[model samples]
Target: MRRSRFAASVTSLLLATGLALTGAATAQASSTAATGGYVALGDSYSSGVGSGSYISSSGSCDRSTKAFPYLWNAAHSPSSFAFNACSGATTDDVLAGQLGSLNSSTALVSISIGGNDAGFADIMTTCVLSSDSSCVSKINNAKAYVDSTLPGKLDTVYNAISAKAPSARVVVLGYPRFYLLGQSCLGLSDTKRSAINSAADYIDAAIQKRALDHDFVFGDVRSPFSSHEICSGDSWLHSVNWLDIGESYHPTAAGQSGGYLPVFTANAS
Candidate 1:
């Protein structure tokens, strides 16, 4: 009877050990399956150009840890993360270089494009350094481009992304107004600031339309940055950084965290 009882004790221990091992394996498999794949593709804003503390391996892409994509991924811990956003990327540049990152396995995709295609940098330079009339003329030219040519370009890029990542939830993020309306700072008049804001609105409208037409999500950042524009006392965007021109007019870390990340996280599924 003593031997029989000892044998039963060992059998119960072995059975418990097997059950624990099986539970562990099942839990690991569930975790793996829950971790979805994510891909980020777009221009400077999406790349975190002004947020600083860039990833050295990203090179000129200027990807920052403070960028919305990285922040989102860190919080969610996706199974696979690909950051292909580059500084100065236009719609065409994305089509040529970035779309390769998207595939059927990509469960989520985020992009911020069309600003460069509108020649925003040039407009800013004109508005900042040149006369008011010069700024107006440059802005008008950009608006013309947005009206005439930008729609087709956006359509092409959106279609390509949808085709490449059929399974992915594509989110196209829009640019924010750089300055508050009728508020002047850094030598910019109300007219110039309004023009810049109008341009931003134009770009956002075009991008939003394209996103909706393609049945993708459009993340509008304008409302989120409404009170944090350049003229705001607590501005989240960087001003003209002569030392680092690339950082100029880009979002600061505060903007990335407070202004951009929340909106992205809300839309990212």
Candidate 2:
């Protein structure tokens, strides 16, 4: 059975914004970072939407201390930690709204963008509530968008980031793969799960390419969450939370700590 083949003994799911972990070597941030600014940009993943403990002052942006950015800032105590990422942000949003936090004084930068640009929410909605064919079709359209358009948008963002913070070390993080195929998971079909994973791969690959092209580090979270995907025993992502739809498909606090923090830390220096 396909399930048996891919049967990872994982629990809980870390359905998250497009940021994965790759178990890279640890590099401590230089002391210069202590005096320089650290700006966190991108989307909900960067903002800590799914992890809870939302900072009341963040308003609708839903910034959370549990988010990896905040955690990093706390550990490093940079001169300034600008948390500008918002929920439902796109590349244009980052260009127009978030880049202001970045400047020559900025020393470390991290962002998790492009998923929203590729219609992640719509794709998830389709895969979750629609037929299997519909799910596949949505993924195909997203893949096409990633291939034809996302790179350019990413270039624009990366260029802007570079221009704003020429001296900063930027890290572009990826999302985790949501499911482990062949599990008797109750929600989506195996076909849909696999399709979603493929979509993540496409998105991550595209994001990684742009990051490398810009000379920024790409942080892949897949390895960190590999055994803990949806069907695993300990999931860092939240499945569909009917009560709090906003939190659906987002990483749990553990995900921010375990899956995302390490990758960002390794690349930040």
Candidate 3:
């Protein structure tokens, strides 16, 4: 059986037998339902590694305490949440790993992925510092991959999620800008930033298209963050791009709060 189909069966069985139980908890935000539940899934950006403190099982990916799930949970109180947003997740992770525990009662889902597939982070690590003649080529390669691959991945993810929980409202999250367009720094350059953001725009556009195709909602976070670079005053994401070493591509605590909260709240209805 397909993984999504099997999970759906399990969910049906649980709901029928009343065997699968969720512990009741209350968040400070407004209660949206008699019982609220969510299953968050995605890559490092979803995990909050570069943004803040780690929370889930410590793999190199470093899921964070201040990730979007936390923000959403805070906004919607008295909800059950299963945050399986491991670092470095791809579309396959959502279809297989994230949906395995899903059920009909699941109210919402949010995802942020495909950065790894397009090699966005790798592009930064490789071309951001090295003044190589091939830097532009590498950026171009990342863009090409994202443009070609993201739509299919979106289809697969949306299909799998909808199959598992037909009633759940799916929200696909987009990557935030990691570079300052037309600006340069010590280790990173504006060119690389522009390239990455351009690639992100492609991915986000693909996500929005998929959302429309599948009747799911797409959250476009790029414009609201136009002037807000990573290290800028009250930025929504972390300053990983400017950092000389360590993880340099994730949201900051404030970034998640400022950028993520509005979307989560808007979509909850």
Q: Who wins the TM-score comparison?
A: 2
Clashing pairs in 3: 27-78, 51-251, 236-255, 237-252, 238-252, 240-248
Local distance difference test scores for all models: 0.78, 0.82, 0.63
Q: Candidate 1: where is the Cα deviation over 4 Å? A: 1-35
The Cα RMSD in angstroms, rounded to one decimal, for candidate 1 relative to the true structure is: 20.5
Give the per-residue lDDT of model 2 (tens digit) for 72-167. Answer: 887778999899988778899899889888888999889999988898877877776579999999999999999999999999999999998999
| Ranking of models by TM-score | 2, 1, 3
Number of the candidate with higher TM-score, 2 or 3: 2
Which residue pairs collide, candidate 1?
none
| Stretches of model 2 off by over 4 angstroms after superposition | 1-29
Q: Which candidate tops lDDT?
A: 2
Question: What TM-score against the true fold does each predicted structure earn?
Answer: 0.85, 0.89, 0.79
Residue 119 shift from truth in candidate 1, angstroms: 0.2
lDDT of 3 at 43: 76
